[model samples]
Target: MKTFTYRTATDTAGGLEPGAAFLAGGTNLVDLMKLGVATPDVLVDVTRLGLDEVTSLEGGGLRIGAGVRNSDLAAHPAVRRDFPVLSQGLLAGASGQLRNMATTGGNLLQRTRCRYFMDATKPCNKHAPGTGCPARQGDHRNLAILGGSEHCIATHPSDMAVALVALDAVVNTSQRSLPVSDLYRLPGDDPSRDTILDHGELITSVDLPALAMPSTYRKVRDRASYAFAVSSIAAAAKVADGRVTDVRLAFGAVAPKPWRALIAEEALRGKPATRESFLAAADAELAAAEPLKDNAFKIPLVRNLVASVLEGLTS
Candidate 1:
């Protein structure tokens, strides 16, 4: 093991330096460092900066600090009542022990679950810059089907982020507040970068806007627990008199970012909450999907799952 130094940061400016990295729960960062994927010379601890409070905002929404644990956020009554999709997504990830240590901000920014990215020996653009992505031709069943580029096909693996985007949450940073919708970057040309966050900036809190809609998060994975999503949908809708008033949808494990299905939501707006409308919306969103040879199954799977979630929201 190489010798590395650890320091406790009093503030963001003083603690998180140019080359220094923040130590949240150390669940993902530590594992990557051990795999030789990430090697930081200095680990700046930021848990003691009083960033672990969960409070209700005056606007009838919730504000979760960056240091708040996943287990705590998942079990909170306010989150369960207003943002059930978030609670469901969090509970579906990690074990009891790991969730107890994983932070909310860290969970949103978790890297892809791509096998090539995890294995340093392989050619993964996410793991090693300029190294060509081998998964574009090799085992790509679990790879992205939408918004993928020739450079990389690794999917975004955060269930929490998918839920947050559908809920229309905003990410609070030291520089300025960034809407959670604008945080992710599409894989149009640069699949190497995942998010738009700048260096030396830390996520302080997440603000969920007030909504009078019903929402749910559905994830289909290989296992029942502790597994990354194969395809997931987060749907929030407001229905009145059997007509869809508003709709917000985001998909996971199908793209480089939380794939927000704007076309689907637009199709559902002002339409009756019927199976026909839901299927049409799903078809419209999946029309542009370009799947690889091995992952062609994901195209139909994602379309069907999106329709199912939309149908369930009708009630």
Candidate 2:
């Protein structure tokens, strides 16, 4: 580990120096630093900038501060009642200790847990652009299946992001507010950049629109607990008179960013809420998936998960 200077920031703009990283929960940043994947000359502590509140918006939406802990957000009455998918997604993630320490913004910015990306000696394009991505032909059983390019196939590891995508959440940054869908970018030629955030831009809060429909989050992993998702679905649906009125589906652990199943949703809208309809919709979305050698199972996994999630939500 490198020796570094640490300071708490009272304001967002003036404190960010070159080679400085903002610290909130230190769950992901500290782990990356210990692995020598991230080295910072200065650490700016933003945990005490009064960004921890979860406020209710005027139109039954939610304005969750960046500093709010995962466990608190999951257990909040409004979240549990209105957006159960978000709550369930939070609970489905890391262990209780990590949930207590992980913050909303920190979770949003968490990196992929790809072995090549974490190991300093490996040829990872995400770690060092133009070096090459060994995961393309290596042990990538848990990597991305969709929205990946030749440069990188690493998957985003946030369960909360999957749910937020389904809920149509907006990420509020210091500079601007944008849809969560726009917050992440596919690693085209530059695998080093995970999100669209600039050097000094900071996330301040996340805003979720009103969601009053049946929703759930289901994750399939190698283990039952304290494990990242091998495949997961966050789904929200509304069925009226045996026909699907509205539907939203987003997948995790299968794409560079949260894979919103917009194609599937379009197939399901105005269709009868049945197993056949769900399966067809799932097929439409998974048709675009380009799974690698070790991760071909993710194709079927995503298909079944999307169908099952929709079935459960409509039931």
Q: What is the TM-score of each candidate against the true structure?
A: 0.96, 0.98
Model 2: residues with Cα > 4 Å off, grouped in runs: none
Q: Which residue ranges in model 1 land beyond 4 Å of their true spot?
A: none
Best by TM-score: 2
Model 2 Cα lDDT, one tens digit per residue, 112-155: 99999999889899997788998877888999889999999999
Best by lDDT: 2
Query: How many times do residue backbones clash in model 2?
Result: 0
Flag clash pairs in model 2: none
- Compared with the true structure, all predictions reach lDDT values of 0.85, 0.93
